[model samples]
Target chain A: MKFKIASGILSDGLKKVEKVVNWKHNIPILQGVYMECTPDEITLIGSDSDESLRYHIPVDGENVDVVTPGKILLPKQAVELIKKLKGEIVLEREEHILVIKYGKKSQFSFVTSNVEEYPKLPEINFDGPSLILKGTEFSNVIRKTAFAAAENDIRPILMGLNIIANSNELIAVATNSHRLGRVILKKGTDKEKQVVIPAKVLEKHLKIFDLEKDVNVYFGSKNQVVFKNGSLVLYVRMLEGNYPSTERLIPTEFLTEITLNRLELLETLDRIGGLSDDGKTGVVKLQIRSGVAELSTNHSQIGKGIEILELQEISGDNEFSVSFASKYMMDALKSIDDDYICFKYTGNLRPFLVTPSSGSPEIEETQLILPVRERDV
Target chain B: MKFKIASGILSDGLKKVEKVVNWKHNIPILQGVYMECTPDEITLIGSDSDESLRYHIPVDGENVDVVTPGKILLPKQAVELIKKLKGEIVLEREEHILVIKYGKKSQFSFVTSNVEEYPKLPEINFDGPSLILKGTEFSNVIRKTAFAAAENDIRPILMGLNIIANSNELIAVATNSHRLGRVILKKGTDKEKQVVIPAKVLEKHLKIFDLEKDVNVYFGSKNQVVFKNGSLVLYVRMLEGNYPSTERLIPTEFLTEITLNRLELLETLDRIGGLSDDGKTGVVKLQIRSGVAELSTNHSQIGKGIEILELQEISGDNEFSVSFASKYMMDALKSIDDDYICFKYTGNLRPFLVTPSSGSPEIEETQLILPVRERDV
Candidate 1:
């Protein structure tokens, strides 16, 4: 394969695909980027079994030119070298060696791997139930819900975000049993569908996609999903398992509802959380009476911390107290973008809901946290 | 102890001394900050076995007020909590508990350690020989030479920066045997003195000292060096050993001298360095002939990378090649704040010198790197 391309174009394309390549993979071929050069454009594919990223650079006589059409597997080291080069770069293949030349007097000779050894990317069918959404909208939903997904594989289904489409709403939900996050967008297909995608893939998409563009998501066969935007396409393997029914996990009624400044509550929680017995659990107690709320935490070794926050508005309950993981509350508060937030409580032991006091009319989001049973010392 | 102090004042003071406190120390008392309140001011001291930092917050009726004179040892956890607080904060001691009050209804009760268990800071004789210099000047000297200090304690003396004062010049030198960095300032006392200060302490000082102020440095008799600036004082134990004579390591004669843009050479070295067999060694070869210099590195498994850099100016030997660790060269180049850097090579096997092409006449600095012998494959 022989091709000439602008340094900037190649660098940008390499960066997008490099995210999928694990250089230390036991299979040497899997540690390379498969490059195919044609008369029209150059395509680069990088994969790590579970996911694959394909990026294309079209041939433009001014910035890109193709002298021959062929394929070669370039190692990660060469990819890194090309990314750091300036000016136009030329790549020419001779047998098993690929020579890359750039600048006035710089050149690199890379030993290429056998292209035939590279695993084939999953075949994705274009004619499937597809949905189109703005990149920003898709990224927003992922950021809101992905953080709640289980980080371990003890329960593989919980590590994925369950996406359900019905009538006119597209809902995304993620829960690690202790807490849950859900976001609903007011746009979807008439045909109902549901699929659980690994939260990691959606999170990675947030970093690679251009927010100004539109992304086309296709629920392809063989448990594979494809996201295409401009000249870049990403294929992710769907988690094959039945996701738990979480609709019943969300509380529908509350005995007490309180509204307060989100930032003030977050700060107070952070201060009290420092006194938790164990830094990991970060449990704190919240007591609401009249219009005042008190947050406190005590540890035998670390002392006690208390903060009093005045509620902006309160209803249904004159007094109540509950203990929960301060980290969960902080995470829920942070996912909200509104200046003011609302907290709904059914009882001390039941899971409570946190939502923005005021948000967009078209979209709805909710966060739920299960209170912890604190043991008296 | 009872006192009211502005949050910002207390936070800033805590941050300065907190650097010296190791929270994971086996001795519980060593993890606490000793606080002493007198009628005039509040003194906070944080210490590790090797060093101590003392910060004073004077009592001004508006910003600071002392209600009673006493002493207490506040735990690191409480110190962290106080740093995050806003508005005015009041502290009152009742029995063994210290109550910290802030905002309208927030308070923390910390169980204080016995103040008598806290180690006392070394007493220094201020009448000993002392030197004064601008904080920026001291910081610059440290920045230029400290990185070359040995990170491991295999050679205890090499882990410190040797400061030698003679005539009107103050010189700082640090080396790990393989590489050396030296900086000289054109201001010193007539009396000659030498001391090796731990590089870690000087590096920490860089973050705490205000660059605009002048720092008074006292060489105390107890093998301790004290740096005092305004209301802050840092006491560091001097390393006890004889520093090696590095004068012989810097060659006055050179077989080749070449000058080039510092940034361009740095980038080229960085790019070629990526091809090193082992990332840690990062060895690269430089071949200089006439007006051209070629930088290259080859690894059996990673292939080869070569870059031709144009020499802005060259003299002496017409042809010579040497191999050295790219990381050392990069560090040396980064430390020199000059647009142009000069390389003076003695021979293929001897150590070479790197210096700024042009710099302040009052300051002189030089970096020496030993060449590595490459084994033929």
Candidate 2:
């Protein structure tokens, strides 16, 4: 393959696919990005076994000159070197070496891997009907829910996020045993469908999608899921195992409810959480009574902290106290774009629910955290 | 101990001495910062074994309101919590427990560390007369030379930068056996002296010193060297061993001398160096002949890179080649404040020198890198 491209354009393209390029691939060819040039476009493909990314650079203008319509497998280091060059980059295949020239200052000739040795990604024919969502909104939903997915577990379903679509609404849910996050979005009449996509795969694809425009998403049962927008196509394998029913875990009613400024609550939790002894679980006790909420955490090793936050409204007659993970609560609060947050709690041992004060009814968004057993230390 | 101070001011003071606080101290009390409250000023001190810092905040216009003159040690977490709080911070010590209150929003109470258990720094006696240097220039010199000091070695002196002050000039030199950096400054000296200061201590002290003013430095044969200016005093222990004589390592004669733009040469080395094999000994070859200098690096596993840099002038007819650690050269070149750089080479195995073309005697600087022996793979 031969082409001339700007350094900025090349760097941008290489970075988009570099993360998916397996660093420890047993197959040497799998570690390289496949560069193919056609009459109209040049494509760079990088993949492991589970996920793959294909980035296309259109050669419609004279800015990008394509000399030959061939293919070559370029090593990871070659792409990095080309991206780091000072000026316009020129790529040419001379015999077995790919000669990259830039200005009169630098010239690098890197030996390319055999194009035939690299495994070609299968041409997936399942063009499932796509759903369009604002790129920023989709990104925000993924950011809010993906963190609750199990980071490393043998249970494949726990590592994936379930997306359920109905005629009126689309719901996204993710749970990692301790915490669950659910986001809802309103839509017109559409066929109902459900699919589990790996959280990591969706996150990587989101980084490449244009934040200014809408993104198209497609999925085919338990086979594969695809996200395509602009010049990038991201394909991910679907989780085969059934996801746990998360709807039953979140409570719909509460014994006590309180409304507090989101930023103030976040700050108070952060301060009190500093004294927590548990590594991942920062058990902070919250007692809301008489338009005031008291947050406190005591650790045997680091001492204790007490933070008093003013409540906007409290509608509880009797004093109630509950303990939950501080980090989980903070993460849930940060996901919503509302000034005020409403907390619904049952007692000291039951799960507590948190939701944005203002959100669309089509989006049934709520975050749930299981309360820790209250004990005097 | 009781005092009311602005939360922002206390946080700034704590951060000034945070670097000196030992995070992994074997003694628990050493991990805490000692706080002393006087009628006029409040002092915060943090120290490891090698270095100690004392930061003072004067009670001016109610910025600090002292209720009692006492001293206490606050743990890292407690201090950080108090610092992050908003509005005025009140510290009240009742027996062993310290209560910290800020506005009406937060109140944290924690057990204070035993102030008596913390190690006490030696009382600095006026043994040597004070010497002054522009804080900006001293910091610049240290920044340029400290990178060459050995990070980990049995030879303790090699980890320190040698500082020599004569009647006319002050010079700092650092070497890690493989490479060396020397920075010289012209000064109106009153006395001549020589001392070796640990590179780490010099680096830490520079952060607290105001770059716009002059810093007063005092040193003695035993114990610690103190840098005091205004309300800040930084004490750093001097190295016991003798520093290596670096004057003998600089080459006097050269077989080839070339002048080139510093930025172009720096960037060229960075790109070509990417082709070198990974390790501490990543060598990039340089060949200077006629009026052009070519930089290249070839690895058996990766590939090769060649960059041709235009030279303004080239002396000596004989062709010469040398390979040095690219990182070391890059660090040395970054220290020079000049548009052009002059490279001086003696022989294939001799140490080479790099100097700025501006030829400012007021700021004399030199970089030395030893050549690696050529080998056939």
Candidate 3:
């Protein structure tokens, strides 16, 4: 293979797919980026057995001037070499060696591996109407809820976000049994289907979408889902299991409901959170009384922190106290994007929910956290 | 201690001394900051077995309002709490607990350890003259030569920079047998004395010095050194050893001399350095020819990198090749603060010196690196 490409354009595309390249033991070739150059465009592909990304960079303007159409599988070392160099790059294949010359003084001749040995990304089939939405909208829905997903493999099914799409609404839900996060996209449409989108895929999804353009989404064989925008395509494998019923976990009836300026309460909790960091049962206590909310954390080794924070409104909750894992609740509170936030809860041990009152690109997002069992101090 | 002080001013003083606080298991009190509040000033002191720091914050401005003078030992957690807070801070002792109140809503009641249990920082006596100089100059001299000091505890003596003061000259020299760094402070004066400053202390010294004002430096009892300004003082325990004579190591006779743009050569070497990083000898081969210098790195897995970099001049015997640890040479190159640089060497395996041609704030600094044995390839 022989071709000449601009460094900036090529490096940008490589960086996108590089994150998906597998670094697992036993399969050394998967650590390389698969490159295919044509007269019109160049395509870079990377896969890690679970997810695959194929990004195409067209010969737009003067980004690439192809001398010959060729394909080469370049390892991470070559990618690092190319990313650091400036100006134009010329790549030529000679036997098992791929000679890459960049700038004026630097030239690297790297040994090429067998590209044929690497598993091929299956061709996705799509005939029905797919959910097409703006990149920002797709990324926003993922970001609001993905953090609450279970990271461990103990319950493999819980390691994914339950994505439910109906005729006119789409909802993303993630829970680690202890905490739950939910986001609703009010303007999405698809056939009634529920899919558990792997947690790792949604993370990579956020980084790949850059340009503010429309993205197409479709599912394949119940086990695979695909996301694409003209030149870039991503396929994520789905977890096969029924997710736990979380609808009943979020209590509708509440004894108390409080409204607060979101940032003020967040800052107050962060200041008091560190006190409960020792090996004791991690609990950050929140008590509400006389139109104010007070947070406190007590640890045997690390001392105690107490803070009284102002609220916008406190109606039903005259006097109430609850204990929660500060880290889980903090994560839930941070996911909410609004100036004002609402908190609703039942009795002491009941699970509580924090939600944004209003924000731009309005969509409902609910974060629910279970209270820890209180101990006598 | 009871004092209402500006949190910003107080925390700044605490941070300087905090770095010296030892977190060793045996001496638990040494892990705490020794804070003494007076009517006019507050002093923050921290000590490890090897070094101690005392920083004073004055109540001359509106920064402090002392209610009562007292002393307390605050653990790492309390110090962390204080550093993150803003605005005014009120530290008041209530029995064994130190009640720290910040902002309007936050309060932390941290149990304080006995201040008397912590080891005392010895009083430094400077009977004769001391090496007093600008903070920037001291920091610059340390920065330019200290990197070459051996980091490991293998040869305990090589873990410090040998500082010599005779008549009007102060020279700082550090060598690990393989490499050497020397800086000549021409405008320094003290009694004829040669002392080895601990490598770790020099590192902390760089971070502690803030203002460009004068810094008073005095060596104590041939084993301890004290560095101080009006409000801040640092005492470092000196390393006891006779330093090797490195002056004779630098060769006066040169078989080949090459001059090049400092940044350009550094960049060229950096670009080629990583190619020889995979279990290879990891040497960046520098070859000088007629009016040009070419740098190359060859590795079995990551291919070969070759670059012909521009040079200012290549006088003396031009045909010469030498190999050096790319990492070591790169580090030595980065320490130099100059536009143009000159390289002088005797033979293939001989040590070479890299020095600045001309630069401002110029106290002469030299970095010498030994060549690695070349492989027969």
DockQ winner among the candidates?
A: 1
Q: Write the per-residue lDDT of candidate 2 for residues A1-377, one digit (tens) a residue.
A: 68887777767878888768985598888888888888799888888878888888988656677877788888866877877775578888887788888886577887877887776665644344557777776787798788888888767698898988787777889888888888888763364778888987786577778888766777544477777767877778888778888887888778878888999898778777776544335689887766678888877666777777887877655488888888999989988788999888777788888888776654557888888887553
**What's the C-alpha lDDT at position B132 in model 2?**
79
Models 1 onward score TM values of 0.95, 0.95, 0.95
Model 2: colliding residue pairs: A184-A363
State the TM-score of the second chain for every model.
0.96, 0.93, 0.93
Q: Which stretches of candidate 2 lie over 4 Å from their true place?
A: A125-128, A154-156, A188-192, A277-281, A316-318, B125-129, B188-192, B279-281, B375-377
Every model's DockQ:
0.70, 0.60, 0.58
Give candidate 1's root-mean-square deviation (CA, Å): 2.2
Question: RMSD of each candidate?
Answer: 2.2, 2.4, 2.5
Runs off by more than 4 Å, candidate 3: A22-24, A125-129, A278-282, A359-362, A375-377, B22-25, B125-129, B278-281, B359-362
Best to worst by lDDT, what's the order?
1, 3, 2
Candidate 1 lDDT over residue span B54-145, tens digit each: 99999998899999989899887788788888889999898888899988778899888888888888786655547888888888899999
lDDT of 3 at A118: 74
**Candidate 1 residue runs with Cα over 4 Å from true position:** A127-129, A277-280, A374-377, B125-129, B278-280, B374-377
Better of 1 and 2 by DockQ: 1
Pairwise DockQ winner, candidates 2 and 3: 2
Q: How high is the lDDT of residue A161 in model 1?
A: 96
